[model samples]
Target chain A: MNNELLAVRSVSKAFGGVQANQEISLTIPSGKIIGLIGPNGSGKTTLFNSIVGYHPVDQGSVRFQGKEITKMLVPQIARLGLLRTFQQTRIFSGLSCIGNMQISAPVVRSGLKSLFTKFPIDDMEDIEDILAFVGLHSKRHLLAGQLSFGQQKLLEFAMALIAEPKLLLLDEPTAGINPTLINGLIDRLRVANQELGITLFIIEHNMRVIMNIADHIYCLAHGQLLAEGPPDKIQNNQTVIDAYLGAN
Target chain B: MRAWHYLIILLLAVSAPFILPDYRTQLAFLWLMVILALSWDIMGGQMGYNSFGNIIFFGIGMYVCAVFQRDSGLEYFQGLLLGMGLGGLAAVIIALIIGNALLGMRGHYFAIGTLGLSVVAGELAGGWDYIGAGSGLTPPLYPGEISERNVFFYFLFFVWAGITFVSLWWVYRGRFGLAINAIRDNEDKAEAMGIYTTRYKVSAWTLSALFLGVIGGGVGNLIGFIDPKDVAFSGATFGVWMILMAILGGKGSLWGPVIGAIIFHVTQELFWTLFLGWQRVALGLLIVLIVVFFPEGILGWLRQRYPHRMRDANNSTEKNKLNK
Candidate 1:
């Protein structure tokens, strides 16, 4: 089996005079933990954005589940079970943590009729379960804004969980979190992958976390793909070291 | 706050004309203000659209209804009923047509775009001689005593406003409310979360237009004349008042606009009586006070002050749910 869930072919995007991603190509196989690493402004985030339909690409195409999706809008792509999380974490701060989850319920996006219907009561159990999984159950009723930064990130993850996406693109999931929380987050990400059978494509700056968590890794420098291999090979790749990891 | 509380308020509202016959007109005006604020809140507060041209629907409604009564030659009551329904339908069509274009703009762009739309609507109505142009249109007279006319229109507004409130309450309790609130909090994220943001935004605007248009017909009849700018499309008065009232009470909460409308209408009426020619200045000062001290509005301020009281009520309900 090809096992490819997402395929990006020579995708190029430029913002005015700046080339954010140039002829970038990659694949996310089904049920795999894929990691993207790059120096600042190296177009790691841009690639994620392009794949998730945040912006139209200047060149190239993105295919999800063997279907062309380069021209699809964000909501349409998301409805196809491709969802993403932001680097800064975008929870509905005005709503309670539970409310955020409730709003993110799959039914909300299911169809026109679902909009007028009350949120299904049975979803509450699932929400509470995921909240507890993220250790946010106790604070479910509190405004999401009141949560700590790490908690907010967890809430965002919980929201994505509620959507029941097939492939989730996480942008810098652990940048602002402390080490302990990072460890916890990594564990949940693992559980979400292995237990839930969801595929993950993550952008990470944390060397240790990405190395340990991702089965395969892609490294970018200056909007160009620098290296791609299993984690240990990417770790040993001289080009990646020279461009991003620095000489030690 | 409770079933009984709503019941008491409804009882008072239903009995207001009889109890205060002298202030019947003023009471009717209160309901008008309520409808305006509530409708505006759906887009401005909930969906974060902040459209300034909602008055376009009201204007269209007034004109369509009056024109129908004039040209259709139907009896007064039949014409009025049919006219109001046609008015609402016309407003909805206009909303759908314009919303697709205007709703594409975000933030200040959307607001300015809608404002321009409002101005353009007024100008169009002013130039169109079919519905009286700058001269204004007059609907057929009410077929009853003046007192009966007041009571009839009063009930018309009361029932309409009640329907508005109840409908909003229903909408806000469901997934639609959550979806719009998500859009308000963050549009990009909302889209990425699979919310067709444009669809929701247009739908929200359409809901406001639907209500505003229907009410506009009744208001045109109540006022007896519809000047293009001053009456039918009074952007300066009705449009601005709706936004201000929503802000004054609270934007996001269900009761905020209602509370804000009641307080603002009563206060504005008082200012008209007390300040006379200076009422505009008094109103301006009131707006400043609301923004300065209660930027979050009265409900937000109350929530900030007694967070636990609200949370406790929530907790009790949640605990009962858990027990069940």
Candidate 2:
């Protein structure tokens, strides 16, 4: 708890008659990989959304860097160095990769005066460097929509990282990525965590991928935390196995 | 290269008064339409909000200036300046209040909400006797000859159009433009990236309102008359025209709406002059044809065909530089 960069406590959220998340609690220690795995409707995405302030939680609170952010909106939460990506890969498809990167830094909140200001050249070059890091350097001017789905995911990752987020929440980053590119995405994620020192809290369904990367794993079942432990322990845990196989 | 292009347009705009003196008044109206279309594009084109309520600011500008000038005991130009100032302020204040509630609605909901606001404004203006109700108030009578009045208003509208164009051009080249395009492409992502979407949306609308309000005041002085529906709150005409012109020009690109406004105004003018009684019908058919065939707009079509150099080709030049 003391080393935690993000703390989610007793957070419960329900949509209409269904309870998507029922009093879920988790902590992501700074600069470590934390995995959230659940069945399709087990509320992995919901938890990510709630934590990022995409939606307000019905109960409980969220703390980032020891400050309460439960009532903050996505932009406010994101400004405090907490960021998240979507399951559907929400890059601005129409903008060039650099444009996407440039806009992702949240420089428009200063009111009307911002309209008159040009982006700093340093930010532009920094975006280029990040694009290169993500292996989209050659496609810097390419529209995100024109890139392959896997490439779009990479661009989305770069967009998220462009802000130098202290912590990143990723929802199904490898969902539609091809097997060949999965290794590449995983490597990028690890590098983003270890080299960049960004705390990663990810929701994934691919067991092999999660097991290979996440230091700690969480398994949610029926809107509750079924099990959480080190990847190897969680992999062999009987309750975790049951939660995955029986959730259908 | 871009400077030369702008230079040619600048020369043409500056010389139009002398070169086509007979058409100065009409040219002024054309510039006014350019301001309307280009400003509308800031929201409807770049941001994809498709607001139909933009005319609300225009009507307010018209009435506020008209009322101030009519009621003010000040000198002619003084009253005019004072009215324009107050009218623009009123528009900014109104936009600030309404932008939050209305801009929250996405896509068609935003469209309908703005449309409702425009119509409600028209209805409210009609009911409010202070601003002349259904009859519409008039600006202070022009002290100069009709031609002199037209020239003065022409310069005013022309200068306003120039300011709107240059400012929007600068805006489109910067981070604000990218943020706007991001909102158009995916607003949720824009927000999640830390760009406060509401602030951007409201600011864009406020900028649009500021121009519309000022130009509305100019329009009141240009015509020297205002009727609630026909002149001031003519949503069925001016309101729809702004959206159609932007769409016809291609919504997202900066020059699309500008080019769209020029061509649309010319066509509409020709119809009014040549076809007379059949103008609206002809305009309707033309719009249908544009919507059906070139929905991406004239600029969009050109961009597709050329794929090379277009000033407003989004990132064509930037893409080229990156490739190099």
Candidate 3:
């Protein structure tokens, strides 16, 4: 319990009559990369949403950092140092890359009074560093809408990084990204997990990327947990192979 | 666009009444339009919560101030000042109460919800006899000369508009601006990024209401009458004009609504009498032209045409400051 960073117990969510996630339970221990993979419509995104308080769980509770966050709102859960990126990139398209980073920066340390205070110009170097880290340094001044879709995904990742969250939930970080940038993103994810000591919970359809980075993997099918184990074991597990890896 | 340009505009505004003493009331109304457009942009443009019922606060302020003045029996200026303060407070309180419910709505739903709010306020005020019902309430007459009254009201509006402009400028350079702009860009992601979207939305609306409410009191006193429908809560006119003027200038940028208001008011006032019976037609044509040619507003048009010019202006200012 003390080592666990997040614990979701018997969580269930329904969209009217559709049971997206049913009796799902999972634990992410500190400083580990956890992967959640499933075929399309297997409730992968719904579970991420449930854990981060995007919507209320129909039954069960979520605990982050030893505190129950099931009843909290998105921003409240976010303020506790757990943040998530969208499956479709969610960068502020009208703002410059730096502007997106600046907006995400203040949320980590301040309260309502910060609203009237000046932009934290003090974070300029930090923002530049993170943008450079994500290879978005050259596009920092351009409106995010002008960026290629891959760059927009990187901008969204950089935004989550700027918040310096304790645990980052990434939904398909490489979904629309350029193939060449995928390896670079994987390296950065490892650095964030190992060097910066940020835990990661990623939902990926890209088996190669997840297998390369995730320490442990969970397989979900038909809204229920199918398998959980080390990457290699999960890769060879007959159930996961038949259900998700497609027996090829 | 620069500090000197602003200074020149300030000089012109300050000297306008003195130079064109005949048009003092029209000039006062121009400043009122500026206040309306600027306040509306805080929600409609910056925060992306396009509210149509902001005029409710304005009416509340007008009635609150007038009622306080009537019942308090205080000195004229003292009563007016206290009344305006109470009116502003009343608007903020109302915003706080309804903000949670109404602001929870998104996009067109929020717009429609707010539209219903002003109509209801109009009906409620129209039927309330305590505030004079439909016959209207006449505020105490200005104590000074007829011309002096114009100048006094002109300066009152001028001062308030200036405060609105400066306060928005200061706040927009800060976290509040970034937060609201994030909401404008994408609200769901803004919440995930840890912005309290509802709190910021309510605060932004309340801020707009505070300005509108205070100005509403001054407007009531300026016009010297408060018709529950036409004057105080005229949704079809003042409320719609607030949105139209902001969109005319540009919705998102800081100076868009300001410039938009200047053009809108000048055009409306200049052409209102000239067109006579065709004034509404002329106004309709103007709206059509704005939507067709300048959907992004005048500033948006200019920015698109001379994007680098604005960027250069900003760069040069920074370069000059660094040199100094």
Q: How accurate is candidate 2 locally (lDDT)?
A: 0.87
- Interface RMSDs of the predictions, in order, are 0.8, 1.4, 1.4
Error of 2 at A9 (Å): 1.2
- TM-scores, one per candidate: 0.97, 0.96, 0.97
The 10 consecutive residues of candidate 3 chain B with the worst lDDT sum are B315-324
Candidate number 3, chain A TM-score: 0.96
Docking class of 1: high
DockQ of each: 0.83, 0.79, 0.74
User: By how many angstroms RMSD does model 2 differ from the true structure?
Assistant: 2.0
Order the candidates by lDDT, highest first — what do you get? Answer: 1, 3, 2
Which candidate model has the greater DockQ, 1 or 3?
A: 1
lDDT of candidate 1 at residue B259, scale 0 to 100:
88
Model 2 lDDT per residue over B118-153, tens place:
778888888999988887787888898887887888
Candidate 1 per-residue lDDT over residues B256-297, each given as its tens digit: 899899999999999999999999999999999999999988
Give the TM-score ranking, best first: 1, 3, 2
Off by over 4 Å in 3: A106-109, A245-248, B312-324
Residues A36-72 of candidate 2 have per-residue lDDT tens digits of 9977889888898999899989999999989999999
**Residue-wise C-alpha lDDT for candidate 3, range B196-243, written one tens digit per residue:** 888889999999999999988999999999998898898989999989
lDDT string for model 3 (A96-168, tens) is 7877888899543487788787654568888889999999998887888999999999899999988989999
Best-fitting candidate, scored by DockQ: 1
